[model samples]
Target: MEQLCDCDYEYDSEDQYTMPEFHQKYKDKLPLLVVVSGGFNGKTVYDEVSTNQVIWFHRVCQQSRVLGRLSNQAVRQYEEFVSIPVHSGHMFNVITSSRNESDPETLEDILTKHKLPVLVRLASEAYDYTLRTVKRYTILLLKTYTETFLQGNCLQDDILLPPPLLLAVSPDISVAIATGYVNKSKDTFHRKLRQISEFVKRNVELKEKEGCKEITLFDKQDSTTGTGNSIPPDLLPSYDEDFMYQDIEPDINWIPPIPPNPGFRPSLPARPPDGLLCQNDTPVDSEMESEKLSHKQSSDVSAGTFNSLTVYDDDESGYNSSAGSVKSYISDMSVEDIQSLLGALNLTKYKKDFRKHLIDGAMLEGLEETILREDFKFKHVEVIRLMKYIREGHMPKQ
Candidate 1:
């Protein structure tokens, strides 16, 4: 009614029936045993279907079963008996004739009587099981094959694989296998990476063995105490050997190095002899001329010379006598002498231009009278001493 099936059907003429014709005539009958052969000989049979024809047959029977046209028992029988190939490697043959064959029957008569629909259905079911088994087994086999391939080739100098086998590999499955191989390789790489520090240390040790002495960057041991030597006696405690080894007691008399006292002044030297105008002439005299002059003034005043008050300007010797004028004394003084004079009078603000500023400041302070007495002699001697001290680069006593 549907213009027959369009599928190009092949059958042995002696069998007297095509698969489609058999299915159409006896669609509702008990399953009949069918012989299956070819390509499935001596080799181990994989569960998967080996051809497209098998796939097509499996789909047809599966549809028929779902539509309630095929019995569950019939499908089960087909799966158990027909799906699996026999162990024998020969042409599989089945006889559908009854034991008593007294009645004559043609090939078509035998096929129709036995019901070809049942044979077709059985064959289709077998193919379905084969296809499913092939798919599942293929995946498992592929995983094992890929793992072995990676193990052999991942780190090899020249990687090699059978081109046909590689071509047969599923792209997704292959990628998964390759990723696992890479991960395993990474673990190996990490282990190798950790050895880098050990390698460096080994090289350094080797260099030392070869007599390449390393330079010490810093020495922890004190240089002064090394070389079998002890610390200096000055640094040691001042105690007898027995006392030193025993539990020690603090010394009440032990004193720390004393710092100089800021308020203490050193006593100055005695005055230089008469005619010794320059301080350099009495280089070794520790006493300042100011102190000597003060002493002289005290003695003179005690002898009643304090009231005379007049200072004499001795022009020839450039010395200001006890009776000298202040102006003549100032005129006879050098720049260094003037600076010293200013310093002694506590008028250091005039030090830059001491001669003029000193005269101004002295007049402002009305120091002429003071200069005529003890103060004048002291200042005069101080100027001479300070000039000498500066020239010799000596720090004068305060």
Candidate 2:
């Protein structure tokens, strides 16, 4: 009775179909496939294009986005597929052949594993393999950036990702990676985003090039090394060597400096008085003056200075300075300090996530075991240890 969005037909809120009817209607047809005018080859028989080929082509299209423009264009030209402007449910139906089940294993366990043909089984394997490969690349990219940029390692040059291949990395992951080259903060968020956009655009341009060499991420050679693999000399002109230059001898002639005009009058400073009364030279009634001055000083101290000092001391001196002094608190620590704390605690694996979340000194001060376990997904023992460190004031100080 539940409504499902089918890509083939106009969306109707009231329209609903049972599992058997939906499967029978769309089992042979590809998901998100629209029969465009001249989209399919004339000689190609529709029946010959099996569901297995459809699924294979679907995944090829998806993965080809990051592979290169030629591959994507080749797949699109040879296959009739519509990826954009389609319902996710419709696509899921094609791959899984299930009206309700969401997991890919459902196709293997209940659908393809029993009733599906050999080709369908092969298609499922291909889909899983390609998906896994893409995921592996994404993880590798994250790890590389984290190790080089986040873990206090020097990243001397700008990060250069292979064209289109970097497209496999999501924007959020890209932003996190950008943190290596850029500081993560409210002010730099848009700058990072703009930088990521430019990278994508450049990658796209490279992807479109007919002869763009496919360079794996992190495999790029260091240009500073001046190795044989470095960019060709013709690409960059030798400005230093080609620029015209000539040395000229210095002139030895000397000229006399100009003298001030005799008619010009210079301002003179005012003279001091002949005599002045010095404090030490004057005599006073010391005994009486000292007593009056002492009385006035005591009154002023009691009236204002003493009270103000008392208020300031009371406000800040509530805590034992030796026990939990402001200097020993973690609230003023930096990201590097947090990393040092993590190293001291032996929780280095969480450094990337900590940086990505901007978990600074102040956040650590208020971190709860529940937050570490649930939000950060830390293990129980790790959470316990961290909480213990926090409670005992064992965290690294600024």
Candidate 3:
């Protein structure tokens, strides 16, 4: 914990049964900076400070799939520090599940729960690889870089580093660099980050000039502030990336055709079904509605809200409404429903048009490839998968 946070923190361990009392004591001072670990028989709490500490703490809890609770304010604050934009409602649910029991202590405890020395060996190997690529530098310079760029707390320890700060260009190494070491310069960290970023830029350009394709974070043409270079073709389909587009085609026996609708008709429901509120079936014709309902109910199991974790009932197919149930079969799927589907499929590029045009499953079932390509501006791959999703009512086999 000290290594990850780079600060001195007070620790407390209490039985799970006594957590209610502990929480009551701290309830008045809502949003205390602490790491609550739901270990078996007891809970381990760390008095943490700073955004990164909270993130790493939550990350550990998340990795272990333990239950954690954060005040609404803490959740919002953590979102501000995340490099990628997070959905305000679903952030809490993703990082912590409902299982508030049996957590492992220490990153190494969970990281190498079964294997011996895996975490240590992995970190050592990462350091060794950095050493190999950075062989031209002297030991002292390497040490300074390690402490400053790799371990510096200037940036958030995100799953992916944004743009020019993509040190090592490997998510595992980037995370290891973020959480594995510590540097405790509070005020001048940003300035140090700037200097290191500049140094990286110069080194990368020099390597490119020397015809060395060993390591590079950003392209020479794009501005440093702009998006970084496209990932190398060699690393194009990462393990997760490989699976992202998989299972999006229907099974062989479930094949169905989606004929083209003449003029793309918006799929906005004429009115909500009896008992359902307007908010429950809000149209996504505008940006405000799109932002509000697009990914609010993203998960398959539950719909997340600001104050509470609400699971969908057996009868309710989608989000909760004041009426107690939401009708969301594919035939009656709303704009928000399709938008959420796009989000789950990681097809964010089509989110705008899909929502703006009120494209629901009914509309999707009739969308033609030419129309999708020309009018909606969807790629060939996207059109294929989307049609399959509409026809099969689920992600299909690749």
Candidate 4:
């Protein structure tokens, strides 16, 4: 017989027992600095910042699967910099967090003062037979161009120097020629990149020559600032004679295209000479008794499983109305679902008619929301909405 103890005991496996967290510095949230560069260095900065942010930001922000791969050093650095407040049971309680700008240990104070989000972009290339080292170096130059541009709050065509150009046409390029990695493949990477720079410069120069003088951050050819574009039309240089790509097109008749397979063609279903689907029996017709029964049984099983999941007993009070409502709302809140919904909305006439009007109106005013102990603090509107809910019916206002 098994012995019974006076006191009750429970055994929790190591996997089941989560480590008791001492303190968290802050509630996790996603940071919103759109970093875009042609190389890995810029990616590194993004990774670093995200790593520092995840512990506090994950709770409040929509962290994606891609952000999960950040290294431990980055996480540790963030935790160290953002000290948790001394609190009962909880460490990084936002309620007790110091908001003083003078706080020596805060992350914001350091980053703002130091100007430390280092933007770096590297280079890369891909190929098997043909030499294409230029791809890698072009990426590197792209990084340099981005950094220089970011020095100002924004950038326009404004004669972008290191834009892509061709080697033969551009003279201003400093071609510190280098061979490709792995195989010292025959290539003109540095020269090609320099050419790209020159090409961009010429485009900008053409724009400047045009009547349009102003530029914006996103002032590409199609979307220039002035009524007319700042960018001038690209004039293709003629060689010895004017020639179209069609004129130099290579002719090939490597293999005569085989006639469409008569047996397995799209118009007909394939069949073996014996006409049996398997070794067991002959092919069954659509209205065959056995086949119909099998299909019906399968459909019934599937419907039963779906009904089991979706249909809940109304009499059971296991889940309250509020809980069910919250669950339903959250179920629809996924990014993919929102994206699909937006796509559908965009296809409607209503979108074309009322989009601008909607943007300008207050009908879209959202609920004031606030991040609680573990929730995110998105904006003032959200904060107000949340406050209303939390305060609702709790007290009588005098």
Candidate 5:
């Protein structure tokens, strides 16, 4: 019979029920209440302790932290309440029962929509929302909401949340309204949390003043801005604003500078040794040897410096019988040519006047280079004729 029933039983003589017998029947049942009354009084009954209401709110806050600690300390508790249970426990029942007492519908909505695939998505989204809202509320309550709730503010843990949440929330406040934690919008949940918080503070004050036996809640002005988390001002003398506050919000600072022009080319000075050789002195005599050597060296050095220039090396055969070449070349040359040629040699404005000097140098170098080259051919005849042309302003007989 025992094998057929799949039951094992033990008997207790005095109690009329055996330990194993009673356990087999009732072990799976949820405890009707565990710490239900004290937890409820702390959270709900004393929630409105007038100005002294923070006592109850503080207890509720402590309870919330306790809930978190309880939730985390025993995964069984969180799993069972947040979802269906893998295993059963009496302690989990206590937490869930009280946890649902404050807001039944919201809890119901979560539970009603609960399914495996849907719950996984909800769990992920919930984690994200929880991370964001917790950071915001904590910032407001601890950093900005200057209150003497605790003597030293033991719970004011400096929460350094990630920037991604701040970045994500930034756009939501402008479009959604203040639904901090509960609703999908920006205004509703966040505003409500702060409203409750401030309300609790006021009630705490009234309770302390009135010496009330019961918790008494009161109305409070909405202290929080939809954007800013109702943080307190910075103490610095320079109009110190809150950390969340900014002079220019949503504007990305520190952009890159403009790039330089790629095609631009700045010119350099046309190098020295730009003068022409005189039209007079021709070689054949030993006396002109020194002049020939100096002129040759000068031409070579000039060539070394300039990237490009015209050279005149074989022009010793020009007829100079009519005039002096230097004087004649200067005078016969148009005044416009003189100014354009000479004025271009100015050292300043190196880039602009650069090409002009090269052209002038080209003419002069060509003249000297020509003389040096053709001195053998022209002898005194060609040189003398060219010199005369320069002195008197006429071309020598070719």
Candidate 6:
């Protein structure tokens, strides 16, 4: 008898009289009965304890399943057990009945049981190599799942449903659940669900109106330009010569004028003898003849003795004239004008020093020699025009 009731019994002391011995000893004596008032209180206390235990059990089962400690079959059995409206006294029997010796249920079976069509579609559509066929199947499954489990009355009051289901139902609900808003208020959940349902309906109607039988999940063709399945023209950059090559125009306004070639000089026109001009109004033959004779004599002497000297003087004068012209041009220019001219000519290496030197009254001859030695090949007129623009404080258009 002790063994039979020992599972539910507790004792205050280990050395107390055994139950059987006590019963035999007291059998001959009159039995004592203690009356208890309010028997309903005991029942109420038991009910409260049992309800708490059941709630705890449900929570444990859910946690175990979510943590993957429980197999799908076990999850299903646990779900069934919790769904049964039984007192704590019968929980052991429910648990024993739900146990099975079969293999654990697979992931696919579990997903299917939960109405997870998106995952199912992903698994099924994976075998097909063709993008179009896979996309069509994917869209079809998504639309079907959205229409079915996501619509109405599928979720339980106490059970926290999966996120995908909530997402399919409404993004707002999913967000709310993530943020603990759904746990705080049931009205928010219901409101979000209604919004989701109405939104899904309107979406369906719009798709139907647009003649969209199935939306594409993966498009091989470019959609932006309605072009065939290749990269759009604007997106594809060109490596052709015309696109890569750019013509850089010389800045004529800021470039300095090219000086005249030193080796070439135009001959000067000859002037009549001074006496010849004065004698043109008189008709004295001897005097005029004597003047002509003297002029001839002077010309003969110059041609014979001083022709080389004359040529040397002419060359010197020509060089001096050119140097003077360039010097005058430089003197008239401001530092900014010189800097701009140098920059536009792409000769900016020594521009700062050169500008300083020019502003300090350095000879233009030295600058001209340096420019020539630097391999600048611009024409004289071009340099002049560029300097003019620089002086006017305007950059020439390329």
> How high is the CA lDDT of each candidate model?
0.26, 0.30, 0.31, 0.21, 0.24, 0.28
Candidate 3: residue 297 lDDT (0-100): 38
Off by over 4 Å in 2: 1-314, 318-328, 388-392, 395-398
> How well is each residue in 1-398 modelled by candidate 5, as lDDT tens digits?
11111111111222221212322333344111000011111222211111101111122010000111101111111111111211111111111221122222232243344321111111111234333332221011111111111110101111211211110011111111111222144465345445545654553332221111111111113222221122123311121333322222111332212222222322533323333232233333443665775676578656642223333222333423322234434433432343343333221222122222212221222344244234223345444443333344333233
Q: Say which candidate scores most in TM-score.
A: 2
Which stretch of 10 consecutive residues in model 4 shows the poorest summed lDDT? 140-149
Against the hidden reference, what TM-scores do the models get?
0.13, 0.22, 0.19, 0.14, 0.12, 0.18
Put down candidate 1 lDDT per residue, 264-347, tens digits, no spaces: 222433555653422334333334775775577678656544324433224533443322333333344434444554455454
1 against 4, candidate with superior TM-score: 4
Off by over 4 Å in 6: 1-278, 283-325, 328-332, 348-398
True-structure lDDT of candidate 4: 0.21
Give a tens-digit lDDT track for model 3, residues 70-178. Answer: 1111111221100110111111111111122233233223323332111111111123343343232111000000100111112244221232211111111111112
Candidate 5: minimum summed lDDT over ten consecutive residues — where? 60-69
Question: All predictions: root-mean-square deviation over Cα?
Answer: 50.5, 30.0, 27.3, 33.1, 34.7, 35.4
Give the TM-score (vs. native) of candidate 5. Answer: 0.12
- Candidate 4 lDDT tens digits, 1-398: 11111111111112111101100111131111111111111111111111111010111211100000111111112211001111112111111111212222222222234332211111112242111321221000000000000110111222223331111101111111012212223254344335444554454322111111111122233322111111122211122332211121112322112222221212212444544332124445444655665665468555542212333332342443333333333233322322222233232222221221111111111212321211222345433432332222111133
Clashes of 2: 0
Alpha-carbon error at 211 in model 5, in Å?
26
lDDT, candidate 1, at 282:
36
lDDT digits (tens) for residues 1-398 of candidate 6: 11211111222222222222322333244121111111111111111111011010000000001001111111111211001011111111001111212233333344344441112122222233332333232111111111101111112333323221100111111110111121346566455545545544453221111111111122223221111111123332132322312333324575555543333444532435554422333433477676776686568556642222243333455554334545544555544555665677555654533432222222232334324343344456555544444333334568
Supply the TM-score for candidate 1.
0.13
Better TM-score candidate (1, 6): 6
- Model 3 / residue 384 / CA error / Å: 16
Total clashing pairs in model 3: 3
